[model samples]
Target chain A: MTINSKIQNINCCDHIARRVGDIAPSGIRKFFDLLASMDGVISLGIGEPDYPTPYHIREAAISSIENGYTMYTPNSGIPELRQELSKHLKNTYNLDYADSQILITVGVSEAMDLAARALVNPGDEVLIPDPCYVSYSPCVVLAGGVPVMIPTCEEERFEISAEKIEPLITEKTKALLIGYPANPTGTIMPREKLEEIVKLANQHGLIIISDEIYSRLVYDCEHTCIATLPGAYENTVFLGGFSKAYAMTGWRIGYAVGPASIIAAMTKIHQYTIMSVPTMSQVAAVEALRNGETSAAEMVADYNRRRLVMVKGLCDIGLSCFKPQGAFYAFPSIKNTGMTSEDFAHNLLMEEKVAVVPGNAFGRCGEGYVRCCYATSLKELYEALERMERFLKKRGASQAATFQV
Target chain B: MLNKILRLLEDDGRLTPEQIATMLGTETSQVKELITQAEKDGLILKYKAVVNWDKIAEEQVWAIIEVRVTPQMKAGFDAIAERIYKFPEARTVMLVSGTYDLAIIVTARNMHEVASFVTHRLAPIEGVQGTTTHFLLKRYKEDGVVLDDKNKGMRQKVVL
Candidate 1:
């Protein structure tokens, strides 16, 4: 058939699912497209670490392949990986999970999808913090569930308190989704505050999906796994991975741990959809868990240095930023410029060739800020800061002139 | 904190006290004071460059001389090692554990100078029994810094 006739015959829109069409495209993607067409742009828009996977971990993967481990693993993942993950969770958080309670995934991204799909029925509401990672709401939507956003503000250090979450709960609420050492803001939820939410969830008979992918990247504070809290283990699905810690993002490996029934439910969906994570990646992840601690600590130290430089530079440039205690981003408020986050990002990209993500890309409450990732080299970060300073000064001068007029 | 500052200075001696302070989030005076105290304590001896002189027009010969030395009563290899290290031509001297008792790095104006130093000076010592000299033709890396490919970009321009 001719191409036009074939397209017409398919009636693509009718065939497309309503839920898929309703999901909004990522707000960061358009800026990426513009950035691709431009030259000499210094971007602070990336969310992942700039470091390559630690050499030993990569070597482990290479040897795993050389030893002929290139087949699909069990639906629940390899036993050794699961055992290591169990040990890791126990050793790090003092939380115990048998291997049967853990399932390896293609990343926290897949684990999140499985959790949503297995738990949410049609119209069940999942309460999530506003200005969260871009995928949380979409995953809930795709699972035929409603995502109710609990708006958090900079005053609370962007933490979702129980007071804010309690009032939002209703009979239809099924789960609460949270990620700490959260993306875009780098705010970590304190342990006491997490316990408050856990209590609330228990009272309301709600599940909690805690994404701890950035758990190892925390600076100046300890990360609390919600599963370890009193009365939370059976109700919490703890999602973690080696991506941020081991610099293994491209490996696409993560795992989830919880009660056996919930994991089995998720695995039932996973068996048909994704059978297993890559065998080589799982072997690499095992090696990372076994011996990658030192390299991970070194990367965290480097990130801490860059974080100070970026945060201080942003504050010096007239954008007030909170001291992020974890993760690699510095979220600075741009409200003084009298421009929307999108316009600020666009104009800065156009004028000074420095790319930063508009904060609203994360959520509605992220309106007056922009997320600047500081995981790049110190030299590039300083250069980006200089360009941003120039852009801010120009905008400030123009705004002052408008006021005078 | 002081050890961290010392490590940064050790990695790159060119970093000023103010730069180190900014990087470490401490006062510049504190870094200066700690470094000065460390210098007085002899924790840091001296700062020197690891240069690849072959890149320049200047010619300097470098040789690694393995020396077999007879051990003294109490000093072991210390007496002979001190004698070899006393010469300015001997860049480095170490008591080794293998077939050689002392490994000495000697730099000179030419091969003749190195030969003279080995035969005339190094061999004449009472404890010095035998010697083997190996000339260094090129230096690919020194002091953990890659000498060649200085212009090669180590950091990617962009990454996620």
Candidate 2:
């Protein structure tokens, strides 16, 4: 063998950090990277809201930085910010917590990481719904936990049953991770379902971690937190963030609310690991929670409008879809096109210059689905939707022709 | 009966087996049975519902792989080809009619994956010669359709 080949072999054979190396070999960023380089592409690939951070919230960040509020606050986060977050949770979801029970992390994204790390012991089993948020299972794996996925069908509006979840539970199962106003599917959990799940968690002694980052973006109905149900606040960790509601995705601010003990554990990790969230970000988030209500409401209203338009537009174009109740996403079934989610997405981007993330990227349950984020502008949505229509019709017509010949 | 049913479903695209059955003076169950038989016979390759792509978010990628084999080694080209085709990254492997003997299509997240497949997975096999890898730059036709702008909104809105 050549020296180069020898070096390559040596590197391949050497043991690396086990957890980092085992990360599932796919993610949302991969598609975004492709979308970035492609010319004339209109992307609904990444779940970023098109709206800017509201004026008042941006101003708060600016004011904080200008006033030299640049130093780290507390490891758990700024007291006022956490207090505001507590109030926001109680007011919105009827979930009560003090600042001591809330840990202000970078975002709900970070809250997920913290929850996974804090609760997942090596080889502990974590149950996640398939067609899930792309990050959940990987985070579980990163924490040395095994993820058992339950497929949530499109016909059921992608809701996971307590019954479906019950079968997957075992002695090794330590936690149940649920993301409502879910990422790709846009399926929001109804209160009854949330209550049932909370009951299951309680019955089985499973820690329930609820990622409610998209809670504020519900279109068809109000979001209900699992933590709001009786007996849940003690065991459930509620993840809320400023990204979706406040259009502050790039700002990277979120919080987790739970029992004092779990909050303390996460806070200890944050103290050593991240020190504190950015000072200006915490200030901005505080303003977002307290003073940015009108702005968030207005933006959410717009997303709801776009949500309906895209759902209607997609179904009009012959794609099978359920109206998303929450989140700025529409998960549609692509099983009819005789292509895998990956194939459909690749063809769409390549042929139409419209980018989407494939369903399978989320999990195996996403096999015949694709997640289209309607988080773009109205013009972009209409244009991309039209392009998808054209792609499908043309494919349909040609297939028909081939059969006839 | 099966041939007629397959022909109708394939040509019309939207004809349900029930409709075909009515036209052919047979029961829907019989029509369904014929379609199933056609699929078993490989005459009807796939049954797919039409879907609009923009409704969901899906990530996609495409790559090409090249393989070199030790021509007269103990394990010949056939063995090397089998090994290359076994990787999940290898989507479709064909003994192509070209200057290169084998053509492989792979899909993955980014260049690093394609590179690793080439370096760690493809190159190290004992009888392998050399391989060429290409990230798909563009696709003019995928699944036999040119993704053009005109076809958008072809389906009328049906209330669900």
Candidate 3:
């Protein structure tokens, strides 16, 4: 055979699949690329915890490795982990998910992909609230499903209510997808709102794809697991993880808890594509579920305190921040600055060495805002706020205006 | 609100009352008043740096002396622990459980100084039965702050 030096004479773009080619690259990526080459940036961009995994939980994984558990695990993950997760769900939300109905994947990212792929037929439509986590709409589109964006306004605290969603449902509507406490916004859907959405889904004969990655990060307010609501369990795919609460993002471990049929379908896809999550992560996750409540609570408490600081800091800088009920983000309004979210982010990074993700990275409705994650240390948060105030002072947004949380 | 203010100061004592007020979403006057009351009530003690002295030129030898004592009438180990902790060289003093009755940390300029204090000052105390002195070799962590900070700022600056 003749050896070929290059795969294509023209461009690699021609070889890309139509479905994959159509998905827009993340809006935050270009800014991140710029940030990578910069120095001394205090970032409030990433939706991740700054803390490391707790000592005991990490030790569990180490002990598992020492016990010679280096091989691939079962496709559905270790039975012990599944069982522990089942108990955890029941204990936390009073939802009954059997061990067989829990499907472990490589983080909730994979779990969402699996859910979309397993449930979506070509041309089906999935209703999603605008300004959600970036992956929500793309997951649907990549699965050959149409994403119908429902605009949720900032006036109503960017809430995902049923009235904003019911009008979007049509015959092809396959699911109602939501993530709360949402990334970039930190908006937690109230129990009543989730119930309304679940009820609307029931009426439309649609499934509910709920990404509850930040379920444990609620501040002062309690997290309402939609699946725990009456008659909502069978119709919802509940995605939870050890990332935010346990600070185990590097471990790449998450799972989906739902009805047996849906889980079986997701498992079928997971088995062929991933085979299994990392065995050590599975071991560590089991420990997280079984004995990590105190660590999770401590992390959430820390996040709550930082949440207060972030919101107050933003408001103090004259960028009115919407008080986030959950997660570690404060989505502050930048409309008064008369600068596009992208320009604000870029300028702030360039001028003051403070990196923040522009709100439009989530969706169109996020245009006049920017998400500031409060999972950083208080010292860094203070420094970031000071730099941001200096940046905004030059832009005339630093008015020291009165604001309420 | 008072506890929240105290918690913020507990994490970093260098924070001013104004900064503490901003962080906890409260008033500076209120925080100041509460902090004043706390200081008066002994809830807020001296604010100082948690220095890793080993990294400095003026490093001192630390010795943990476990004193096994007989409980005296009525006063028990409290009277003895009070007497030991009163020493200026004693860094920490606690009445412990198990084999030891009192555990005291003694910091001195040299090992000889530490040994001299353990024998001359500590063993001479009332009701002191025996002593076990263990000299500290190295300190990797102090007051919840890791000395090396090797893993500081290693997390990815941004992610989806």
Candidate 4:
């Protein structure tokens, strides 16, 4: 019997699961598509690094593949990776986590998904700060949970104080998801503020899913790993990965360390969904853990230099950018242009061929700003800054605001 | 701070004090002062570009010469090395510890000029004992930069 390839009678979209339908598609994708058709555009919109994976890490993967280590290991991860990562957390933060408590996922992205799916029940509310990484709230929504966003702004340094969170907490609030060296804002939560959040989490019996993917990217500041805080270890699902720190985004490796029950639950979901991360990537991660600090430090230094230029350049162009403490992005206030964030991003891309992400794509509070990643080479960054300055001046010439240039 | 400034300038000698100060998050005056001190102390000798002369449509030939030098009584190889380096044709000269006592790279308009310099000027020096010259063929890289490299566009114009 011939298969009927055409089922024109039904629309496949209608039958999509309710939870899947609830999640909105990433808004930046359309912006990127429009950008794809253009030429000679200098982009500060990429979230990943311009640097390729360090040579030694790539060699490690090459050797691993040559040795025919292609088969899957345990569902959690290869034991060596888990052990190295465990020792890493201990040495870095003094947080004691045995290898059993760490589960290596595809990336921090997958770890976030696994954490949300494992913990959230129907109608459970996950308290996430607004202007967070775009996936946090959607992952919760996909897990049949409601996401309660506590809006944060530049006045607070975009920090989520427990006082603001306290008013949003209900009995249904099951977890507090936070990422520092946060996306868009680059706000690294201070230890005192983290302590307050830990206290709040304990009092409410809430789980804290902390994404510290940018933990190593802090400029001139020590990162406070929340799990090391008093009473936070038991409640925090600490997410970390090599993507940001080691210039290893393409390697697709990250880890989640937490209390036994939460880790076991996350592993349970992970085993069924993704049996294990790629063995070669895991080997690369092992190399990254064993010998990657010096390399990571060098990359961080390079990014720090670019960060200085980027912040100063944005301010020079009269965009009023905040001095991002960590991460590769600079979120600058674009409200003075009398254009919405989307309009500013689109018009800038169209008129001047400089691509920046509309900040509101991250969350509601992200409006009136735009996220421009500074991980590109210094030459490209300089050229992009010049183009942006010209774009702003051309606009300013038409409007009431006159630029310094 | 001095080393950081040196590194920035060494990478791209054209970077202005204001630009380096902006990149390092230091004051322009501090960078200028540090640069002045560095120059006065002879810590930074020269600011020059590493050019791939092959790309310039100009005739240039380079030779790597291994010179076995006779050490002087008091100054050892230093006096001889300096004497050889003082020649305007000696592009790079060093007293290297190896089979050869002195290693020098001499650049001239062509093979004839390099041969003449070696036989006439270099070999005739007091401490110069034996010299073996190897003509340079091509330059794949120069000064920590790959020459004539095509742009490898691995990254998308935009990414999540």
Clashing pairs in 3: none
For model 3 the local lDDT of residue B17 reads 84
Better of 2 and 3 by DockQ: 3
Q: Runs in model 1 with CA error above 4 Å?
A: A1-14, A37-41, A396-405, B22-25, B47-65, B72-75, B86-90, B105-126, B130-160
Give lDDT per model, in order.
Answer: 0.88, 0.79, 0.88, 0.89
lDDT of 3 by residue, B14-111 (tens): 98888777666678899889999999999988899998787799858889898999898999888988888889999889887898888888889999
Work out how many backbone clashes candidate 4 has: 0
Q: B1-160 in candidate 1: lDDT tens per residue?
A: 9889878778778777876776788898999999999999998888877667877787789999999989999988888889889999998999889998899999999999999999999999998889999999988888767777665443333333
C-alpha DockQ of every model:
0.29, 0.01, 0.62, 0.75
Candidates by lDDT, descending order? 4, 3, 1, 2
Per-residue lDDT tens digits of candidate 3, residues A1-405? 223545435588887999998997776778899998898999998789899999999999999999999999999999898888888887878788877789999999999999999999999999888898888888999999999998987788889888888888889999988898888788988788888888888988999999999999897778888888877988999999999889999999999989899999999999999999999999999998888989988888778778877888888889998789988889999989999999999999999999889999889999999989888998899999999999989877798645655
**lDDT of candidate 4 over A257-312, digit per residue (tens):** 99989899999999998999999999999999999999999999999999988888
lDDT of 2 by residue, A1-405 (tens): 699787777765247777777674565555556766767778787677776688888898899989988997989888888787777776777777876788989888888898899999999999999988878988899889999998889878889989999999999999999898888888888788778888998999999998988888886467787877888888988888888888898788988888888888888888888999999999988888888889888778667657766776677677778888888888877888889898898889889998888888888888898888887766688799889988998887212111100
- Give candidate 1's whole-model lDDT: 0.88
lDDT score of residue A60 within candidate 2: 89
TM-score-better candidate, 2 vs 3: 3
lDDT of 3 at A48: 90
Candidate 3 stretches greater than 4 Å from native: A5-10, B1-5, B18-30, B68-75, B78-83, B124-130
| Model 2 segments more than 4 A misplaced | A1-15, A27-32, A397-405, B1-160
Ranking by TM-score: 4, 3, 1, 2
